[model samples]
Target: MQYLVLASRCLIGVVFLASVSTKVAGPAAFAAFVRSVRRMLLVPSGLVKPVAGVVVAAEAAIVVLLAVPTRATAVAGFAVATGLLLAFAGAITVTVRRGTRTTCRCFGASTVPLGPAHVLRNLLLVAVAVAGGVAAPTGGSLRLGESLVAAVAGLVLGGLVTVMDDIRALFHPTPASRRH
Candidate 1:
């Protein structure tokens, strides 16, 4: 149980860290993310920057909350993470349904348009949040060996999740005929 909770916490924290890093990497990155959000949500231009700011702040909060080694804080972090993931999934669903080809500025300068794959990825993250929340312990400490193992597992899983788009592209490269 401790392993599960720790792994979950690390995984969620790493994923959010990656996300927040990309969006705030520079002024241009953030502006691109805001544009993508506006197109994805069909929000008024005026609200786009504020909405993007809130999203980035929320992601940062999750990372901070999960970093705390307390049960309550960790659970709160998981809840926040779940809420954000669900919101993202819902927005992505709407965008895909509307056939909007908005570029996904998620995790840096992704040129890939909004699609079902994005929705699926968000849903998967939500599952991780729920599992972490459910298994979270009130108070516990992992041994050195256990800590190292759990941390490594979580980091690897988080890294893989963050780069899933790239992984998919590798498997489904554009056909040679289309390159002409």
Candidate 2:
């Protein structure tokens, strides 16, 4: 049980780290990400740069917050993760419901548009965050077998979350649009 919670924490941490790494790859790439967010969010054109910076920084912070093995930090990470996922889902929902399709620069530049899969993915992440927050373990100790299981679980879950957009793109034909 403790190992399960730990694995969840690691899975979410990996997701955040991946997001930050992709967004922070280079200045032009980050600027493109900013533009995508502005388009998808329907925000004022002037706010794109700041919004992009905040999103990237928040993802980086989530990675650091969840990396700390302390109980308090774990709780904070989970809380922040929940909020981020909720915001993501809300944003995607807005685009989908309003009949606007926009590319998601989530985890770097992507041609895939927002769809139900994105919302589902966000909700799934929200569930993981909630679970981790409710059952976060304070100790770093784990038995050999438990450690192995936790490592495998975290890797598999992280991998799945990382490619969610790809999976959605393959199946969702009517996603907002691959281009602006």
Candidate 3:
């Protein structure tokens, strides 16, 4: 149970850490993400920057909250993660239903457009957070060996999310364009 809980915490933490790195690489990259958000209609044009700020701040918080060794902190992190994933899933679902194709900017920069896949992906993450939160102990107690194992497992899973777009693209390539 501890392993499961700790692994979940690490997975979400690493995910946020990787995501934050890409986002804060520089203002240009962050601005691109903001633009993508506007294009997706996740927010009105005027509110794009503010929304982006909140998203980035939340990601930063997730990284910290999930890392601290405490049951309360872990639960808070999972709660935050769950909300973020649901919000993302909702945004993608709306875009897909509207027959709109827009880049996902999910990781600072990307060409993957909004699709059912994106919605499913977010749902999966939400499940992980929920399951972890449930299994988490009231007191975050782990031996050195257990902590190491959980961290390793979490990092591996987290890294997989980082390049998931590319992996999906490999299996389902975007159709090529041709000149008329």
Highest TM-score among the candidates is held by which one? 1
Question: Candidate order by lDDT, highest to lowest?
Answer: 1, 3, 2
**How far is 42's C-alpha from truth in model 2 (Å)?**
3.3
Q: What is the TM-score of each candidate against the true structure?
A: 0.92, 0.88, 0.90
lDDT of 2: 0.80
- How large is the C-alpha RMSD of every model relative to the true structure? 2.9, 2.8, 3.3
Q: What lDDT does the true structure give each of the candidates? A: 0.86, 0.80, 0.82
TM-score of 3: 0.90
The sequence of per-residue lDDT tens digits that candidate 3 reaches over residues 6-56 is: 889888888788888788899888988787778787577889899889989
Q: Quote the RMSD, in angstroms, for model 2.
A: 2.8
| Residues 1-180 of candidate 1: C-alpha lDDT, one tens digit per residue | 888889899999999999999999999889889888888766788999999999999999999999998898889999999999999999889889988878777777666676888898899889989999988855576798998899899999999988877777788765321211
Q: Which is the better candidate, 1 or 2, if ranked by lDDT?
A: 1
- Quality of model 1 by C-alpha lDDT: 0.86
Q: Candidate 1, residue 141: CA error in Å?
A: 3.8
